[model samples]
Target: MVETMRRRGSSKGRALDLIRSQGPISRVELAEITGLTQATISNLVRELLADGVVSETGRGESSGGKPRMRLEINPASRFGVGVDLGADSSTFVVADLAGTIIGRLGIDGPGALGPADYVRRMADDLAHLLDGLDIDRAAVVGLGIAAPGPIDREAGVIVGAPSLAAWSEFPLTAELSRLTGFSCVLDNDATAAALGEFWLGATEVGSTYASVYMGTGIGAGIVFDGTVYRGSRSNVGELGHVSVDARGPECPCGNRGCVELYAGPHAVIARAREAAASGGIDLEFTGVAAADFAAVAEAAITGHPLALALIEDSAEYLAEAIVSLVNIIDLDHLVLAGSAFEKVGAIYVRTIQHIVGERALSRHLQHVSVRMSVNGTDAAALGAATMVLQEQLSPRSLQSVTLA
Candidate 1:
């Protein structure tokens, strides 16, 4: 009897995980997949439904019986805010429990604002955006800020982000909370993007995955065994700092031959500017201009020799880093994200896919799925919004908050 009860309890727990990850399933389908009795599935569904996490979304087509009511996550019951603080810009998105962006505000960053002033500016921006939204302020469960880093997630501080020099040791979470009067959570841009994908993008897939953010710099977010792993100091996936060249140029992170010094958007743009200047060509990549790497890439696609060489070199450097990563993590999938990748991303995807397919050990186990993020160019911002949804809606994250 006790063994039977234990199995029943285990089934319920698995059911909850599924509902949280892939919910709105009917009792019959749940039973078939979970191998639990329909009665047990019904019991747990009732509990979740009562807790206001799940709701009926009309009836599904019947399969030789009365149609079952379709269940779905109740996004309106809770909501969270996502803030993506990037070198070039900042974005704010308010998301419901279902990871839907009901209201959004994208802001140009105060590039020169220091930590204190930046937070204050962010506060004003957030307030202005919130005021415009038709949502009830009370249902906003928290705010999740996705900032470039080195970061200290536990302390809620952004530490030594090169792009936002003023954001160093910035108590962004506290300041934003003070400004908006809501609980706030903070994470590195890549990590938050990983969570965004894990929770909303690849939630239907396997447990382990990586979200690679290819922005001004390269960073990765790791989801392992169904949880976001932030590492020792929330600085786990600083992949850009990986030394791919022994005699390469110096990096701001005090490393020589770091990948960022070679392949990051800054590096690519610098190369473009250098080429333009040395060749006496008329091209401008100065001051807040989109990186010329994209233009160079386009030129390469059209048979421009110089542009093709530059992109190929960048892709090779990226391939080296990605190959190393696949060996270490053997990830089930790799999501290429960020604006840098958005423009010339195909080259990256194709190049990395070829290398990893030909080299990584996991190539035999399963062909590593290297694909562009569905969120595309605005992924960080969208993921920033998703950060809110995960915290409020995901079961594990929900445990961290105390609802008022």
Candidate 2:
């Protein structure tokens, strides 16, 4: 009896995942996809419908008889919270079962605060966001937090983060779960962004791609064969530390000429500040680095030569790293995402496309495609939400949802 129940639960999870991934599908299609009998599909669909997990849409054309009823995951059946914990700020988002953001909030991050205080603040913000919404709190399945890593995902601990030192060795997932009274999951920001693109962006199922996340730092999230290619320790895809120049400046990671030093937002803003100080560029300087980067991005978009030069220079370094990555991974599609790409993303897109097209090792074999993320700055947060959905509803293990 126990074995039968477990099997049924597994089948139910699979059926729900199918609806979420390729919904508006008929029972016949589900049976075909799952290799289950028509009776099993009917039984599963009936249970899902009764549970409010799925709803019948209209009907599809039939072969010879009556039209078949189409079914989809009910968007209102459940909710998930995703948090992007950044160096300077944290973004909180609430998403429905359909992976749509229904509400969002942002607050200052744990810059100087200890682990306990940071967790309390996050829980309070999450509670406030949920309380303000009209949805049922009981329907919330879980919370997913995306933070900068080297994380100990299995242990649910933030092992280390360069900027967020106070969070290191912190039991982030357990603390969040305790404070929020919901199960919680933890993932690196870049990996979450990659999964977000795969789950919600335009990528086709079973396609191999990489999302290069450029925020305070640079990293890549690699998804191959419908799963994130998290390396052995889940610390893969640290593309920022990839060496682009042998004789360039030293990196904190004990490397010379890491790509992040040249292409990260901080680097771009630092260069912009230097340019403004040189009196060659007639742009106003905001002491705030993020604001300064935004001004420089605006200038670049408006055809200012100096600002354009700074952006293009950053893009060039990024492109070089991308070319090397593509050659190694044999990837054909690349996504640029994160807060840094919120403005003047097109310039980076164009530069990366041009360089990859011209210099990729497989240029003669296939054309590489580069595009901006649909979710833009919110990709990580959205991906974090998707992680919760995947963990709760999907059959696949999220152990694969890591950096590689």
Candidate 3:
């Protein structure tokens, strides 16, 4: 009897994952893929449907028999809110169960703001956006926050964020939940970006992969065996702290030479500004925004010396970190993501791919594929939304991107 019960529980878990990923599928398909009986699939689907987690979505063509009924996630049955909070700004995105973004808003705010002020402002901003969209308040499932580290995942607090000082020890999830009346999940920004790519990016390689995020900071998310690998204390894949130069600039994290301090947005912008100033060329560095990184990259490609130099320097550090990670984890694939990458993404991809393919231990047999993220400039925010979807659909895995 105990064996049977265990089997049943396992089947239900499989059903949930399969349906979450490829729902709008029929009973036959679910049975075939899951190796469960048709009757079992039907029973599980019915249970999910009755609980309002799944819904009937029209019908599929039949093979000389009755048409099969399609079942999909009930997106309207539950909703979620995703927020990407950074030192430079915050972005909120609302998505349904189907991972479709319903509404979004972005704002500029200094990282010096207290957690309470930031959460309250985010709540207010999100409310305004939802109100404009005429969405029902009760439909929101939970809040997912993508924040900088280090994080206390269980306590839902920001342990220490040097990049954003006021956020230290902030009760982000609980406080934000109180302000917004929605449950919240908090995770590291890079971890959240990796989840976003895992759920959204397509690849023919092995499931184990790394998502290297280049933004105001450098962070990475490791997707291992189809699950995010959060180490003890729910913090892992912190590539920013990986030292590439022991005698480089002092980092806010107390490290003398971390990858982030050398390769993140700050590094690139600082380099660009220095070059411009040295050449007596007063140009607007505001063009370094995420929305314009691609254009900057194009200019660099055309032999723009300053742009190319800055991008090359950043890419070198980035590639160094990624190569180290690949050697350790042996990830079959790597994704370059975030606003920083959008500007010099090709340079990053080329550098990382070349280094990994040439020097990684895994290169002895199979080459590690390095590519840009599918999310583009909006990836962090979009992945922030996917965090909500992950929570609502696959509660087995923890969510990234919390409210504060």
Candidate 4:
């Protein structure tokens, strides 16, 4: 049994994933896919239906005798709240079980605000977000937070996030839960993005994949057999910390030549700024990380020599780290996410795909699908909400995007 998934409960949870992803499917199909007896599938589906989690959408094509009834998730049965606490700004969203965003709000990052103060403001923003929607407050399952980590997953805390200093050693979830009256869960930004992608139901059922998130730093979120795989302590996918150059600069993570040191947005923006200062590039410099990175990303996409070179170089370092991840997990797909990738995504995608195709040991098995997030940079916030839905929307299976 997959232990990470076990913590969320199983049997029913597993069935729900199958139905959410492959529905409108029949109970026969569920039995076939899950190796459960028809009786078991029936019992499970009955619970889901009674709970208003699953609905019988319509009849399916007859295999031999009567057409079978198809089952699907009921989107409006539940709701979740997500907060993507980012470096430059944060995103707040309310999503139904279907993963369709109901309401969204964006605001400045915590900046120097202490964790307690930030939580209070966040509670107000959340109230504002939910107030705008005609949603039942009781229907919101809980809250999910995606942030940069050194996370204490069990404690529901973001421990010493290097990028968001005031958040370090904070009981983020407890505070949010206390103020908002909803149980809260916190996870790495990349992991949350991957879950958000999984929650969207855009991938093949039971596929193994990973999302590579480019933000102030780099991280990966892995999904094995349609389940989010949070490694021990929920820090499974630290792609940025993987070494691409053993001889390169020292990283705060106590690693030499970490891939993030070269490929992450901070490094990219820093390079662009130095080049622009030296008259090597013609981009306007903004001290703000998001603005600066966006400027570089825009120039790179437009084919400016210095901008392209810097981004491409970062992609090369990123490619090295990605190949390592692919070899380890043998993922079926790779998703590129985060605000950092919003503009210069093509450069990274093309470069990473080239390197992975050439180097990944699993190349003989199948081509790994690579693509941009449908939600773009907003994926983390959406995924944060998915984490909540993952808990509250549980019946026996998977729900990404919309259920009905």
- Which lDDT values do the candidates have, in the order given? 0.74, 0.86, 0.76, 0.84
Task: Name the 10 consecutive residues with the lowest summed lDDT in model 2.
Answer: 395-404
Question: Judged by lDDT relative to the true structure, which candidate is superior, 1 or 2?
Answer: 2
Query: Which regions of candidate 2 deviate over 4 angstroms?
Result: 1-10, 282-289, 397-404
Measured over all alpha carbons after superposition, the RMSD of each candidate to the real structure, in angstroms, is 5.0, 2.3, 4.1, 4.5
- Rank candidates by TM-score, best first: 2, 4, 3, 1
TM-score of model 2 vs. true structure: 0.93
Q: Over the stretch 79-185, how does candidate 1's per-residue lDDT look in tens digits?
A: 78888887666778877666667777766667666667777887888778778886778877788888888988878887888877776776778888888898888
Kindly list the per-residue Cα lDDT of model 4 for residues 73-95, writing each as its tens digit.
Answer: 88888898888997688899888
Give the poorly placed runs of model 1, Cα more than 4 Å off: 1-17, 20-23, 27-53, 58-68, 201-204, 289-303, 397-404
Sort the predicted structures by lDDT, highest score first: 2, 4, 3, 1
Model 4 TM = 0.90
Candidate 2 lDDT, 127-192, residue by residue in tens: 889989976878998999888777887788877577677778888899889999999988878999
Each model's total of backbone clashes: 2, 0, 9, 14
TM-score of each: 0.85, 0.93, 0.88, 0.90
lDDT of 3 by residue, 205-300 (tens): 247888887666778888876677877776787898899989998887888889877777666666666767798333465643443344446658
